[model samples]
Target chain A: MPVETIDRSATDMKAEAAQVSADIDAFFDGLLTPVQDGRERLFAAMRHAALGGGKRLRPLLTVAASRLFAIDRDRALRVGGAIEAIHVYSLIHDDLPCMDDAELRRGKPTVHTVFGEADAVLAGDSLHALAFEILADPATHEDPWVRSDLVLELARAAGTSGMAGGQMMDLAAEGQALDLPAITRLQQLKTGALIEYAVEAACIMAKLPADARTPYRGYARNVGLAFQIADDLIDHNGDTAAAGKPTGRDAEAGKATFVSLLGEDRARQQAQMLIEQAIEHLADHGDEADLLRGIAQYAVARNH
Target chain B: MPVETIDRSATDMKAEAAQVSADIDAFFDGLLTPVQDGRERLFAAMRHAALGGGKRLRPLLTVAASRLFAIDRDRALRVGGAIEAIHVYSLIHDDLPCMDDAELRRGKPTVHTVFGEADAVLAGDSLHALAFEILADPATHEDPWVRSDLVLELARAAGTSGMAGGQMMDLAAEGQALDLPAITRLQQLKTGALIEYAVEAACIMAKLPADARTPYRGYARNVGLAFQIADDLIDHNGDTAAAGKPTGRDAEAGKATFVSLLGEDRARQQAQMLIEQAIEHLADHGDEADLLRGIAQYAVARNH
Candidate 1:
């Protein structure tokens, strides 16, 4: 049965987010149970970073996208969890003193602040390894090909060309004169890659033909950009408590971002346009894609 | 036709090491060429760490193991290169000030020392991602099952129950009391896991049946432990320039190591005994296993 129908209001997405957050947390809790060794600190730090936080938007996106093809829910969640693992690892490293240096994440002290830098780094590395482990396990899928493809997809999304690469671009851009295109390209690599991987994973799981992915790619790309812009806007205007971390960091770092390059009003307009375009990519589907549509709308809507 | 024969001496293995080292470095250089984007710093750090440093013993072990089965040479090297990437990434992170806090690795400044901590972390993260990316690529193995299986094996070697978990244990054991068994288990996870994976990757690439793996794994286990003990011995007795890094770190930190627990003479003898035992695990093979035997001898021979 369909979980939610078309024309669903914003309240429906919140409920779905809550459910996904709980599921992902439970999955990590069970998966990260400390082995009978002295590595309890590592597991604890990983749990601290990965559990009980975030909107679970990436996993939610994977779940929502999987609905477009009627894929297996549990399998979809597993894929989503791997992607979120990558997301969480990046966040842990990003919040390090050498990086963003922020002490708060998810409304609490960051991993390095709570666990110290060594454990924080190892915890993040463990999570990074976990992403591939989860994807490669037969439990994720019976077909080895499916698992291998997912590993490839997620690895690319997390690697230098994707998240890490984007991070490098961001680091290099700090206090430099990055124009509109440069900032857009930087954000595309840093955040857009994983967001695209979320939906692409669903496509891979469903064994959808490569040629059939154009619309989904378009949907994912548009939504990812829209989501990033909304993030910059929130970082500009929203309070730290609401953001679960410090806000206006872009301005503080003197870094160029969507809001920096396009001005606040135009950036907001661009995000709205992208969301509409993202939804337009799903015109081929009906009620089955309602969740994705909700997610696209939610991309910009999260800031409000 | 064979690389070397059963009676090959330490000089022959050194030549082989130099060859494998060059091949792995070239592979990384080609793979890590920075995009036109300004992420050169990240790529530079990765190249600085991966390109010119270690003995490439892990990849040599991989190459040597693959020779017994006549696996595709380039494919075997790719697998070896992937394994070496993990080794390099781990070193980069381990040398961070929060961990070993060392300024030197491979006779030169460590990644964090040269590139700043943020870049160091990103470079290591990129290399970690690169390992999976290399394994998952169609070039690594034509069969998806083979690629997927390789990923599962390497991920297991690198994850919580393996390398990362071992690092956590080592961190917690600092200046604390750890007995012989605890220290053994720690080295097995921290260093042995990767060394074992080096051989396991060869078995995986050769399509050696799971049931046929007992001897190889036994060999791996013994050689890995022997290698660790030899490493500790080197740290205990060898000078900085010879070992390529600071020495006597374990005793200085009051951390119990193979050398600390077993004592200098005992650890040296234990490594020698383990190397012989490792060689015996390959008793079933004849002239084809010559390199493996040579490596077993080389493990203990390195310290001498």
Candidate 2:
């Protein structure tokens, strides 16, 4: 990889990170209002699952990428918020007792642990619907074409061949030996699809045509791989306190991951290489790509 | 109510319903092909859950209503297919052990029973995503506005205050005492919302203005109510075999339903009255609405 890294101080990164949580948190807080009717519990569970906690990594990536096109601030937050909603809903479902059966998330009780299985399921489902709702609404983008593409792309990303399909693959792979290619395909479907959506959303919002999107697509592809490797590394050897739930879930489940296949040193090097290449994909852009470049670094650094 | 019934022979209703099942079944068959990969289980589960059975009432209603405007047959089937997908996915979730805890649907084993809980849940999520994907595809409609509207309305109808929200209410209402008004509200959200969407999709495709939709809206509202009453009546006195799944679940769960609150005689009367009124809303239309009229009667008469 070429040495094309852009230098930014820690303060710059910190400032860029500040509003993502606040903005997305506020977006969900407003969207999921409380009710006095029988459905109040559902909304409350949705609020609890969607509003608080987590790194907000997917939305943050979207927001950082949006700066590349100088997209409208409100539109950026809404797009980013919808992406975050999809990510959070996936987490809630993945943590169900019938699924991962975990009790902790973001260092706190999982939605199923706190709200019970029925509410957890409904809450995840409600968030799933709401993500498309936000994207389809005219407020997300004045152009219905953009809104339609966002809905189509997000649905594709999260559907059978996308994140949801990847989840099915992950479950079926339990207690089985998966080679590197199979593991890569699984991770690409599960986590990588949504992450790629986060970056591609900016390109769509920017009105870039299909042919013009190769560079951004390449950028998103690299970022997704790097981000997945970082996650495997975190689950491999990171501190429980920093990692939230636990370390070594992949090993505990006997599931093969990038770290399990490649080892930690190689995984770290692979993630770095992907990040540099991801940054290189944006070589034509000027400093508008700073936050995006910074994000490629942060996705690996925070987890590596 | 003034008599406005369209006298369609039983053979006509049967023939219309025949193609609907075949069409939508083929749609899912094509959408969810078998896979040799790890994700095969997930797609198989989704296929099991989505294809092969049920009343196909929602999709049938969309088809019957589409006749009112002579909507492009292919467009109507796709829209109807998407709505059916949403309905089936909802049923899969509702039948989970944590929710309704049923063992049979369309006289076949539930998805969870056959595929395990994780696969079942993921299948439901995949179908839910597929519904939006189908709607957002340009092939669904040449106009992005039409596609966007369909996506928006479907998402709204399925989201927090739509069909999913109603599911939450139904779960919360178990063993509780709900009055007539409260029960009506619950039924409206739980089942009525999607039924309305099934009818409204036609008007949307026709590009009817908001004010011009009053009659159609009135027709859908009545049909939705009549449909819920019929469902309650089925659960109240329906034979197990004809109903596919066992009947009397509401009574067994001690859930308040229209039949429980209104008595079978009154509930039956109310459904007939609503169906008649629903038919009356179509008085201005010619023979084009005959199939829709038949559906209104079928929704109420099937159980009553």
Stretches of model 1 off by over 4 angstroms after superposition: A1-11, B1-6, B9-12
lDDT of 1 by residue, B1-304 (tens): 2445544645566777788888988898899886667898999999999998887878998988888898877888999999999999999999999999999899999999999999999999999999999999988898898899999989989988899999999998887899999999998899899999899889988888998877888899999999888888999899998998989888888888888788889988898889888888887887667777888888887843
Worst 10 residues of 1 chain A by lDDT: A1-10
Tens digits of per-residue lDDT for model 2, A103-137 = 77888788998889999999999999999999989
Off by over 4 Å in 2: A1-10, B1-5
Residue B34 of model 2 has an lDDT of 89
Model 1 lDDT per residue over A185-274, tens place: 888899999999999999998898888888998899999899889989999999988899989888988888888889999999999999
TM-scores vs. true structure, each candidate: 0.97, 0.97
Evaluate residue B121 in candidate 1 and report its C-alpha lDDT on the 0 to 100 scale. Answer: 96
Model 1 achieves a DockQ score of 0.87
What do the candidate models score in CA lDDT, each in turn?
0.89, 0.86
